[model samples]
Target: MRRALAVLEQVRDHAAAEGLSLTELADTLGLSKSTVLRLAQPLLDTGLLSRDRRHGHFRLGPGALALGQAYLAGIDLRTAAAEEAHRLMREAGGTVHLCVPDAPHIVYIDKVENETAVRMASRIGSRAPMYCTAVGKAMLAWLPEDVFAQVVDAGLPTVTTRTLTDPGLLRTELARIRNRGYSVDDRENEPEVRCVAAPIFDHNDVVVGALSVSGLTSRVTAARVRELGPAVAAAALRVSRTLGATR
Candidate 1:
């Protein structure tokens, strides 16, 4: 079992870069070429790894991606937030999004649209800039300082006139978000859209994701936005509790 796991690990790294030759894999694992081939055969047959007949190189196959997708689909956060997102939409009269940080971006994993006249552009798999969305800012406000610095150093693009392009100013906003227990995007991502969001914590007290209520700025005005902030935060907290969060 240990040998099989080691072979998979070596192949996983090589598959992302230049695929490893059988002999190279043997050398990397300190095993004989025949032993490496023998260990890899089962993986190849199971579709976890694939070998090139033309170049004699080995890489990950479709089965690996299938397993990854399956794992992501089984994450508790998505299930925990599903009903809460619907509840938020019913109460707030806007679209509700459940998103997770993907480095400098936030990816929506679930959504519930208001049954009224409001409509939002986001879909289940849509992504948005982390610096310009309320869901992104909610998660970012809780990230460790070093990690937050890394994201800011990469670059913050201006999506609209209200977007915060300066790192110093963004930090100030994040601090306020941390204090308020939620974040707000005042037409930062789009000229006519606005959102309020709060972070969801995991059992480890780590911020695993965010939940946001979004709508057209005309309907979700400044006064209404303020009223929605605490509601969003409370809904997010409910999801955190369902995920076994203690913090």
Candidate 2:
């Protein structure tokens, strides 16, 4: 069963449009052509894989699209992220935010506040720029190159003295965020406010949102940001898994 699913995944990844030859699938899967055929037989029988008549190459069939549609239909981003966001607020002792990308901006969909922590100005449904805020940067780091370029082209306005207003600098910062698995807003979006955030992905392995912990700079100091980064990242990963992200 696993081998059959692997075959489908490989075809989906490498041959969705153009399709792949049996030999190619065999080489990619490190299996002989006969063995690849044996594993793929069930998928073909179930209408998950089809051979192009003209090219005789394998491609994802309509059954795959049906499965994808069903999976997406069952997923609700806010509900999927709620528990993890609350747990992050409790564990990190700060306000937690769930935000989804909105082109040059991100919209806060949920905010979990620690009762004892200082209340943040951000409210659910509020919008923030993608260049300066931790949650925005977290989503941007994993988004496609064209989307990132569009945000840069739109503008990188200064929200605070620490905001990365320069395009080149923001690009470098995004690379760092990808390397560390989280992003930091060091008083960039709001004065005396600091935040650490990580990207959340869906079953398609596409970044759909971000999870963040925000607090006053005095309490969430530079050292605290470093300490909280990985924990925030782990929390976001759990949310992603609940959304059916394989990665």
Model 2 reaches what TM-score against the true structure? Answer: 0.74
lDDT, candidate 1, residue 187? Answer: 97
Task: Give the distance in Å from residue 247's predicted Cα in candidate 2 to where it truly belongs.
Answer: 1.3
**C-alpha TM-score for every candidate:** 0.69, 0.74
Model 2: residue 229 alpha-carbon error in angstroms: 0.7
Question: What TM-score does prediction 1 earn?
Answer: 0.69
Candidate 2's residue-wise lDDT over 23-70, tens digit each? 989999999999999999889888899988888799998888788778
Record all residue pairs in model 1 with backbone atoms less than 3 Å apart, i.e. clashing: none
Error of 2 at 43 (Å): 13
Best by TM-score: 2
Alpha-carbon error at 176 in model 2, in Å? Answer: 0.5
lDDT of 1 by residue, 86-200 (tens): 8888898999899998878899999888777567878889888888899999999998887677778779988899999999999999999999999999999999999999999
Stretches of candidate 2 exceeding 4 Å from the true structure:
1-72
lDDT of model number 2:
0.91
Instruction: Quantify how close model 2 is to the true structure by its C-alpha RMSD in Å.
Output: 5.0
Runs in model 1 lying further than 4 Å from the true structure = 1-75
